[model samples]
Target: MMADNLMQSPENWTESQVSTWLRTLCVKEQYIKKLFEEEVNGLVLLTLDEDSLMTKIGMKFGPTHMIIQKRNELFNSKQNSQQNAKPTRSKKTKLQQKNNSKSLHCLASSEVPSGQVHARDKCASEESQTPQQPCILTSKENCKPRPFDQEGIDLIYVKHRVLQPESGAFDLISPCHEFKSFAIAAELDRTRLQAKFAKEVLKFATGCMNIRSNGTIHFGVMDSKEDTGYVHGEVVGIPVKDKDIYVDALDDIEKCFSTDKEHARHCVRPPRFIEVMDRESTAKNYVVEVDIVPSVYILKGKVHAVLLPNFNEAANKVQYEKKAILRRVGSKTEPVSDSDLSDFFQRVKERDAQREEAEKTLVLSTPFCQDLGRKLTMLITSGKKFIENDKWFIFITNKFKPDDLSNIEWLLNMKILSVFDFDPDSKISGLCSKYLEHHAANMHSLQSYSKSSDRSIKGFTEKLHLFEQTSWLFCNGRSGFKANETPCDEMTWIKTRMTLLMVYVSLICKHILPKGSLQVIFLLTSPVEKPLLHTFYGFFTEMQGHTDIICICESETNFQRWQSFAEEICGTETVNNFSVVGMKMSHINATMQMIQPVKACAKKHLPVFVKGTCLLETNREEHMASLEILTVAKKHLPVFVKGTCLLETNREEHMASLEILTVNHCDDTSKDFINEEKANIEQQFYRGGRVTWMNFWLAEHKYVGEVIERDAYQDVSKLLMDVLKFPL
Candidate 1:
C-alpha cells in the first residue's frame, strides 16, 4: 500500500531520480543472479584479472562473457537515463557525461591489465558483496561429504603391467591423450539429460543393474523392403527367470548404458579357449566392485559410476506439482515459479533443516559410529584404491575437473599422513571414526552405499562384504539385489550388461591386486617356465643369489594328461627340484601351502618369493587360501616369512621376473639361490595351457642361460623399479 501511494505522489519524482534511487538499493549478488538468467551458456568461470575494479561484483554466469554483459547493463542503463534527463543542460555537461561513458568503457575491457582488479580478486569481491554465495564448490575430495564403506564389488581386476612396446592395445585408444581410460565420455545432449538421469536412477538407484555386451542392428528383410525397419538391441540381466522379467530388465538396462562395440571385449568370461588371450587381461581389467581391496584400486574419472539418490518417483512427482503452490503465499522464500529461476539457496536451507532433524536421533545414539560423513568419504576413496601386495604404494585422488587429475590412474604420492591433510593430521582410520560419529546427520557408520538401491549407508555389512569370496553369475541382469529388477523380452540389454561385467573384471584385474594375507613360496615345474626361470635365475644371482632358491619338477601325472603333441613339448629333467604334495589336488590352496615353507625359509635368511601357475588363478586361490587359513589351520610365520601367491601367467618372462622378485624379497640374513653361479636354474622354460593346470606347468632347465617367453620378463631386468622408498 505504501509503495503504491509513493508511486502516485511521486513528490515530483523524475525518471532520473527514481533510477538513481533504485541503484542505491541494489546489491551485487542480486544483479549477478539477473545476469545468470540472461546468459545462454551454462558454465561460469570466475577468474581473477588485474586492473579492472569496474567488473560488477558477484555475478559470473558464463565464462568471462557473462561478466562483461552484466557490467554493460549495469552502467549503460544509468548513462542513457542520465543523458536523456534535463535536456536543457549545457554542452559542458554533455561533454562530462561522455567522459564518464569513456571511463566505464576502459574498465570494461581491463581483464588482466595492470593496476586493474586481478580477475580472481574481482570475482571474489563481487561474490563477497552478495548475501547468497554461489557454490563453485568443485567436487573436491574434501567436499565429498562422505566416505564409502566395505562392500559390494563383484569382480575386481588390476593391470599393473606397463605398456609393452609391442602390445597392439595402445593403438585402439587415443594416442594424443597420454592415457585416457578405456571408457570414453560423451557430452550430455540437452534432451537426453532427463532420460540419462532416469536411467542411472533405475540401474544404480533401483538396484536394477544392466551392462551392455554386444550391439547389433537388423534392417528389414530384402523381400519386405516396403516397410523397412531396424532393431537396435543390447544384453540385459533381470535376476528373475520369467519372460516379463526379461523385458523389464532389458528396458532398464537399455535406458541407462548406451552401447559401444570397442569396449565390448572388456568383460570377464567364465572359461573359454585361451589360445587367444591370457587370464590377467580379465583380472587386470577396469574394476567395478565395492570392497576394501577394491577401494584402493579403481582410479577416479573413468566412466565407472553414477551415484543415484534414493528418490521415490511417486513422491518426486507429487513434490514437483505442489512446490510452487506451497511457495506462492507468504512463504519464507518468494518468487519460485514456472520460470527457470530455480532457488537452490532456499531449497538447501529447507533440506538442511529437514535432514538435520531426521539425523538427530542417530547422531546422538550409535555406539560404534563416530563420524558417519568421514566414514562414507573414506569408504568411497578407500574402495577406489585398495592396497594389494603390501607393495608400499600410495594413490592420490585429484580434484574433479582439474587437468592434473585426468587419466592419472596411478601416481606415486609421498607416503605421509600430512599429504592426505586429514584434520588433526592423523591417519585415515582416526579421521573416519570422528567424522562418522559427530558429523553424520545419521550417526550410522559406513557400510556400503554402492550395493544398495536405497540411500542407506548402513545395515548391509554381512551381505555386501561377501564380494571377495563369492561370484554371482548374472543371467540377463538378475544377479540378486534385494528387490531384483524386472526383465525385458528383447535380449538387447543382455549384451550391454555383459559388456559392463567384462570391463568391471578387467579393471579389477588391473587394480584389485589383493595382498596375500598369508604368503607362500611356489616351485615352477613346468617345462615352459624353464626358459623364463633361467633368465630370472641369472638376474637374481646378479643381485643376491642366497636370497632365493629355485625349484623345478617333472611329474609323471603331468606328462600323461597332455596329448602326444603337448607331451613332445614337455621334457622331464629340466624342472629338477620342484616338490608336489598328495592329490587332494582338486584344492589349489592346499597345493600352495607346500610352497609356503620355502618362502618362509627364504624370508628368514634373505628374501622369498611365491609362485603360481601360468593361469595365475591366485585371485581364486586367494579365497582358497582364506578357507585354508580358517578351516585348515593358522600358522604364525615370522614377519619376514612371506608366502607364495599362486599367480597364473603365460609369459615366461614373468616367471623369470618372479625369480628375480624372490631374490629382491631377501635381505642380508636370507640366502639367495637364483644368481649367476647357480645360473643353471635360469635354463628353465614353462609349459601347459589346459584348464587342468594353471597357464604354466613346468619350467624346463637349459644347460645354458635361461631362455624366457621372449620379452615378458622385463620387470625382472629392471631389478630396482619395485623397491619400496621411504618418504623423507
Candidate 2:
C-alpha cells in the first residue's frame, strides 16, 4: 500500500505521512516526525542512502538507520501484494524453471567443489558490497581450483559462470557480465597465468577508479524511488579453490607494477583479494574476490583487455590496452589531445603573469597647481639637470617653433632640445639638409644673444648634427594627407599613416636617441579632433619608458575631450594630467609632478626597445618617381604617412562604428586579442605570436594598460557581404 501510494503521488508526500509510513518498521512516530521536520524532506527521503540521511540531511542516527529498513518493508509488501494478485504459473513455465535448476546443479556438481560455492558468494559480497547469488560453473576433467597463497602460481583451469535464478536451472548468464564485479576465465596457460591475471586485475581496477558522480560509468548502482526503482547488479561469483588464489593474484599484480618502468608512478595502492564461501553447496570449490582501493589522486595508465559496463550500451564491451588520459568532453571521459594541453598551459601562464603584475607599484600623474608651478620652474631653472655622459635625450614640439625656444633659458642649457620642428613624413635625408639650415640659424641666434666668439660656434655645431638627426625636423601629419590621394578608403589610409608614425618613432628612439636615455617628449597641438588618433594614443601607451606626451589643446572642450580619450586609451580612470587652454598653472605643475617620477625611475631601469624596421618590398613606382622630385626639392623624408579621421562625433556613434575601441585595464588581453584578431589583426598592437613577450612585459608596465577594441560582428558581416557581392 505504501509503495502504491508513493507511486501515485511521490511529490505530494508530507512530513505526517512519512512518520506514519515509517512507524510500523519499529521507527518511533515522534522521532520520525521530528527528524522528518528537521533534516528529512518527505519527497527525497526515499532517494537518500542511510549514511547520506544522517550526514547530509542532518538526520538522527537511530531514525536514519531505520530508513532503509522501512523502505525494504514497503518494497517487500509491494512484492507480496503483487504475488497474491497474480495467477499460478502454467505447466510449461514450471517445467522451464525445473530444467534451469537441474542444469545449474549438474554444472555445479561437475565443476565447483562444495566449499568453492561458499567462497564465490563471500567474494561477491566482499568486493561489490551487495547481496550474493548462486552461480554454476561447468568444469572439465582438467579444471581445478587454485589456492590464493600457492607460492609458485600454477595453471588454474576455470569456466564461465552462470547465475541460478529462483526455481530455475542456470539458464541466465550473469546480468551484463561485462559490468559485473567478478570476471571468469576458462582454460589456463601454466607458465603465463600470473602475468595474465595481473593484466586483467588492473583493467577492472581502472574502471572502478574512473567512476565519477556525474560521469557515464554508471554500473554499480542507481538510486530509484517507488516511481523509479534503483538500478543495481547482482554480485558476480568467481570459482577458485581457496582464498590463497587472491594472495598469488595480488602478488603478481604488485610485481607487474614494480617491474613496469613507464607507469609505475600512477599506481595508487596494492589490491587485496578476499575469500568467500557458499554455505548451502556441499563442494570444496571457493570464490576469490579482487577489491581495488580508492586514493587521493586519480590513477591513470594503460591497461590490457577489460570489460566495463556502460549505461548507454546494451552490455559491457571489451576495451583494448590504450593510454588512459580521461578528460571531460561534454559529459563523457574522452582522451585528451595536444590542443587541450596547450590551452591549459596558456591559461596557467596568464594567471601567473596577472598575479605578478598585481604586486608592482603604479605612479599616476595627478593634476595640481603646486606640482604645475614646480614643473614650470624646473623647466626654466633646472636646464642642465638631465645631463649624463652615458645617456642621450631629445625633445620635439608641434606647438612651439624655433623662435619661441630662443627666449627660453633652458634651451641654451640642454643640447638635445633643439627648438626645430620636424615632420614625421620627412625622410632622414631631408633632416640631413635641415641640419645645415638649423646650424646656421642657431649660430646667428646665439651670436646676437651673447655677442660671443666663433670658437664656441664649433662646439655647438659639433653636437648640432646629433641634435638635427635626433630632433623633430618635421613630423607633420598634414604632409601624410597630401601624399595619399585616396579619400574613399580613409581608414585604410589612416592606418598607413599611423603605421608610418609608429615606425618612424620606433626608429628614432632606437637609432637616434642615446641608449639608456633619461627622457623623450612629443608635443601635439589640437590632437583630439583628428580621426584615428588612437594611433598616437596607442603608441604612447605601448612606449611606456620615460616618454611624455604634451597635448596643447585649442580650447577647454578639446582639452577635456582629449583627457577623456587619454583615460580610455591608457586604460585607466586617472591618467597623466594635460594642460588646458586657461589652466597653465595646473598643467605645468602636473607635468612637473609626472617628470619627478620619470627621473627617479630612469636611474633604476632602462627602456624596453626593439630594433629597426626593414622596409617592405612592394610596387613603389609612384614613390620612386616622386623621390627624385622630393630630393630635388630638399624634402625627402624617412617614411610616408597618410592621416585620416573617423567622420563621427557622438560617443555612441563612435562605439557603433567599426572603429577600434578602448578596453578597461581589467579586461583580459587574451580574450581581447581573440576578438580583435578575428575582426582586424592590424588594428591590435598585441598580435599574439608576433609579439608575445614584448606585449607581456609592456602590459605589465604600470603606465601601459590600454588595448584596442575588436571589430564589430555587424561590420564583419557587412564586409563579407560586400566581398560576396563584388567577387573577383
Candidate 3:
C-alpha cells in the first residue's frame, strides 16, 4: 500500500510512517527521536499505555498523554471506516444510513468528545481542514435556530474560545481576562442569583465609568483546567430553556445602579445582549455577550458609585442597598480609600482656580478704549517732562459730561477762589470766569484755551513760589506745629497751596510751558509727616478720576509709606494705577534719562486696572472690629491704627491703654514695637483663647440691629453692641 493510504489506516503504518505522523502532531523533537529510536511502529503506538511510554520512551506526561489520545482517535476512525463499507439491505435503510453519515461528519468536524482533546489541538486541526461542504445537520428536528447571525457567532468563537496563555481558566475571577476588556463567567449563582450578579455588574460598571472606558462580560462560557495544569475557556454555552431567566436577571441587575432625575438619561447604558452559538458543541447552546458601555455624562470632580443590594438570610429578598465607590487600578477594580477621595477633590479645586486665573489673564489682555489710550499717552509724555525738569506740575483734564454744567461751574469757581483768594477782579481769575460762563458750555469747548500774557504768567509763577514755601512749612512741621501732628488750620492752608499750585501749572502750560494731557507730578524734596502724606494721598485720590498721578519721593521711607497707604485705602489693583517712584535726589537726573526711552514706548498702550467694587467703610469697619475683638480676647494686647479713632474713643478705656503704633514713626524703636506686637498677636490667636468663643461672638454680632441700622462703621458698631451682651 502507498504511505498516504497507510496513514489513513494507522494500524497498517510502518515505524517510519509513525514517526512522520508524530512530527505532524508537533510533539517535541526529543520525544519523537526517542519513540523512533525505540522502534515503535503504529501497532506498538496503539497498544502503548501511559506507564509504558514514560518508562520505555522516557516521555513526559504531556507528550505521553497526547500520543495516547492520537492513537485512540486513529483506532476509532479505522473501525468506523470498516463499518461504513457494509452493504445495506433496503432503500429505506440506505436513506437512514445516509442521514447518519452526515451527522457523524458534522460531529467529527465541529465537536470534540469530552476530555479527548485540548482546545489548542482542536484549533490546529480546524486550521488544516478543508472548507466544510454543506450538510443537512441544521435540518435535524432536534436542532434550534441560532439567535444571532453567523458572523456574530463566529466573532464570539474567535475572541472567547481562544484562551490566552496567561489567563486562569475555571477561576472565580481572572485579571488577565479583565486586562483585555472582557471577563468570563460560567453561570449565575443559583442561591443568590440577583444579588450576586448585581454585585459583579456594579463592580465592573463602576470601574469602567470611573476610568471612562468600556468592557464586556461573557456568560455561559466555562473555563476548564487541562491535564498540563493550564487553564482556558470552553464554550459549553447556556441551555436554550434557561435563556429567558438569565436575560431577565441581567435586566433587573442593571436597575440596581443609583441615578438622579437629572442624570437618569446620562447614566450607564444598558448592557447589550448578543446570543452566540457554542462552536465546540452540537447541542443548541448559546453564550450571552454582555457589552458594557460606561456613562457618557461623567462630570469632572465627581466620583462614580453604585448601589449594591444587600440580601436577607435566604438571599431571595433585598434588605437594603449600600453605596460603593470603585475605580480601576490596572486590571483590577478597587474600592477608593478616604484619603484618595479627598485628594481627588483637592485636585479638582486647584484645577478650577488655575482655569479661572487663565480666564482673568485673557480678559485683562483685551484692548482698552481708544480715548483712554490717548489720555495715557499724554500722561506719560507730561510725566517724562516733569521728571526731566525736576519741577512740580499738575495737568487737569475735564472729565465732566457736557450736560453737567453746574458741577463744572462749582469746581472752576472753587479752583479760582483757592488760587486767587476769591479776588474775582484779578486778570487770571477773570479769564477763568469768562471761560466757565461761555466757552465751557461743552466739554470740547472747555478744552480750548487762549494764551495768557507774560504778566499773568509771571504773577502765576510768583504765587506758585509762595504756595511752595507754605507746603514746606507744613511738611516740616514748622510754624509751631509738631511733626506728624498738623493742626486743622495748617492742613486747610496746605490744601489751599496745593490748589494754587495746580492753577499756576495750568496757566503756565497754556502760555509758555509745553501742553499735555491730565496728570499730577509731585517732586517731594523733603520728608513729610504721616498726616501730611495722608493729605497728599487724599488729594491725589480725589483727582484720580480726572487725571493720572505720579509721586516722586526724594526719601525712600516716604515712598514705602505712600505705597503701603495707597494699598490699604485703594487695594492693590487700584494702587498699581498710581505710580510712586523713590530715588536719591543726586541720581534723579540719571534715572530719568535712562527710563525716558522705555517710558516713551510704553505710552502707546494703556494699562488696565480693575477697581475694587467693595465699599471702603465696610472694609475699614471690619478691620477695626477684628482688631478690637482680638485685643479684648487677649488682655494687654497692643494694637496699631492708621487713624486716631481708638485714641479718641472714651467708650473703651481699655483700648486707650493699649500701645498704639503709628505709621509715621519709621524708626527702629517703632519697628521693634510692631514686630513684638505681631508675635504676641500670633501667639494669642493660636494658643491663648478658645476659637469657639471668638466664632460665637462674631456670629452673634454679625446681624446686630444697631450695625444693620448704621450706615458707617457698621462692623465696629456691631462689635460694641454685642460686647455688652457677650458671655464673659
Candidate 4:
C-alpha cells in the first residue's frame, strides 16, 4: 500500500500524505506551517505554481522555486509511466474504484481543517471523478482567508469599492472629506521607489503625527472613475513583478524616518505592511496596507518638522533637501503658515510664563526691589518737574531757496507744537518771520550790542528774557537773501544768525540762567549747502559746550551733514551733548515727542544717543554718566526713596530686586504707571515679574528705565515724562 501511495499522482494524495511528501522535499517548517494554515491538500498543492507559492502562500522565491521543480519532476515521471503502459478496461475500472474510495476517505478524515471540508467534498463528488476533469482552484469557495479580520476587511472593501460623494466618500484617492486618517495610492514609481511616492508617504505620515493620531496608506488601490462620471476606489493590485519595488519603497520610507535623529520619534516603530487579497478578482492580485504610528516624543512648545528630499522632476532625481511641518486640516495635509507659526510661538511663550509662575513665587520686599521702587517713584516725580519748569529753546533753520516757498510752508504747517500740547497763540509766541529782513532790526541791535563795552551781564539778561518769551526762533535763509543779493549774501546772513544764536546762548549760560539748565533743540529741515558748511561748522564748534543740542534733520543728506559737523566739533567720531536724527517730515510730531530735554548738568555723563532704531553709548564713562543723571534727577524730585543700601549684582539678583520694587511702586496711587484708562498695562506687569527689563511700550509710548548699580539709576524721570505726556 505504501509503495502504491508513493507512486500515486500528487493530485490524488491526501492531506497527511502531502505533508509527508513536502517534508521529504526538505521544505522549510514555516512554509509547511503556512500550507497547513491554508488547509492545502493534494488538490490545492498541485494547483499552486511558483507565483501562488510566493504571493498567495507568502513564501520566499528560493523555497517556492524548489517546491515547483519537485512538483514538475513528479508530473514528468507520471506522464512517462502512463505512456509506457496502456491499462485494460477491467484494470482501469478497478483502479478508479480504489482512487474514488481513497478520495472519499480523505474528505471524511478528522485531520482536514473545518473550512477545507467543502473543497475536499467537492473534490470527492462524482463530477470530479471523470478521467479528464480539469482542476478549478479559482472558485470562490476555495479562496484563502484574508490576512485582515472581518472589520478590517470591511473597511478596505468599502474604501476600495464604495463611492458616496454626498456622504463625503469620493472615488479619488486624494485627501478628501471622507477620510482624515486614511490615504490611498495606486502604485509607486517603477524606476525608483523614492521619487514622488516617497514624498506623499512622508507628508501623510507627518500629517498624522501633527494631528496626534495613527493613519493608514493603502497602496495598489486607487480611485477610479466610471464613464457615468462617478468615482470610487478600485483594487488595482501591484503587478507581480513590481510588487517587490513597492515593498522596497515602503522600506525606504521607513528607513528615511527611522534614521533621522530629529524626527525619528515620528516613526517609533517600523511601518507594518500586510498583503491583502483582492476580494472581487479571482486572479492572484493583492493590495498592500501600510500602518503608521503617531509620534512618541513630541516636544513641548515646538512644532514638529520633518525633512524631505526635494525631487527634481526635470532632472528626474533628488536635488536638495527641505523641511516641512504638516498638519491635517479636514482631509488635506497643509504646511503651517507664518501667522500660524507665530501664534504657536506666542502660545508657547505664554505657557512658559505660566509654568514659571507656578514654579517660583515673587517677593516684593527685597532690598534691590525697594531700590527700584524708589528710583521709579523719583523718575515719575522729576519727569513732571522737568516738563513743567525747564526752559526749552527751539531754533528752526530753513535753508530753502526763494523759489522753494512750498517747503517753508510745509515746515510751518507741521504739528510740531501740537505734539507737546502747546498752543501756538499762547505757549509759543510766534511762527517767526520767513524773511531775514523782518529780523534785520533785532540782528542789527545784536551785532552792535555784542561789539559794545556797554553790553553788560545785566543788559544781556534782559535781552535773554525777551528771547525766552519767544520760545521758538525761526531763521529763514530765503529772507536773509534779497532779490538783488547773491547766494554769497545768503550764506553770510545764515552765518550771522548762527553766530548770533551761539553768542546769545553763551551769554545766557554765562550770566543769566544757571549753567547747564537750558535745553536747546534744532530742527534743520533744509539742507546746509556745501558752500556754508565751514561757516556752520564754526558756529556749531562754539555752541557745542554751552548747550545740549539735539538736531532733527528731515532729509538723509541733512542728517549726514549735521552728524559730520557734530563729529568735527567733538574732534572724534563720538559726539557728546549732541544728537542727529533723520526722519521724514510726516514723522516729525512723533519724533519730537521722543526727544527728552537733556539736562546741562548731566551732559558729560549722558553720552548715549539714539540713531534710527539703535541706542548707542560711547563707552563705560557714558554708561556711568547716564546713571549719574538718573541719580541727580531722582534727588531733585520730591519722592520717597527706600532701600538705598541694596548692592548691585548679576541679572538674577537684579530681577529679584525689581519684583519687590514693582510691588512697592504699584502701592502708591499718586505714582501709578497705569491709570484707569490703561488698566490692562497694570495687569500685564503685575501678573508676573514681567517688568524686569528696562525698555517697554505702554499705550504705544516707549519708556526706558535702567538700574545699572546700587547707587546708579537711569534717568527714567525724563523718559517717564515723555511717555506719560504722549496721547494714547
Where does candidate 4 have its weakest 10-residue lDDT segment?
418-427
Candidate 3 regions exceeding 4 Å error are 1-160, 163-191, 221-236, 240-244, 250-255, 261-267, 271-280, 295-301, 310-316, 319-321, 346-728
Candidate 2 residue runs with Cα over 4 Å from true position: 1-368, 376-396, 399-413, 417-473, 477-493, 510-518, 527-532, 545-555, 571-574, 577-728
Whole-model lDDT per candidate? 0.25, 0.35, 0.41, 0.41
TM-score between candidate 3 and the true structure: 0.24
Q: What TM-score against the true fold does each predicted structure earn? A: 0.17, 0.22, 0.24, 0.24
Model 3 residue 158 CA deviation in Å: 6.1
Q: Assess candidate 4 and give its lDDT.
A: 0.41
428-461 in candidate 3: lDDT tens per residue?
2322344444322211111112224555755754
Q: Kindly report which residue stretches of model 1 are placed more than 4 angstroms away from their true locations once superposed.
A: 1-70, 73-701, 704-728
User: How many backbone clashes are present in model 3?
Assistant: 0
Please give the TM-score that candidate 1 achieves against the real structure. Answer: 0.17
For model 1, what is the error of residue 134's alpha carbon versus the real structure, in angstroms, after optimal superposition? 25
What is the clash count for each candidate, in the order shown? 170, 51, 0, 7
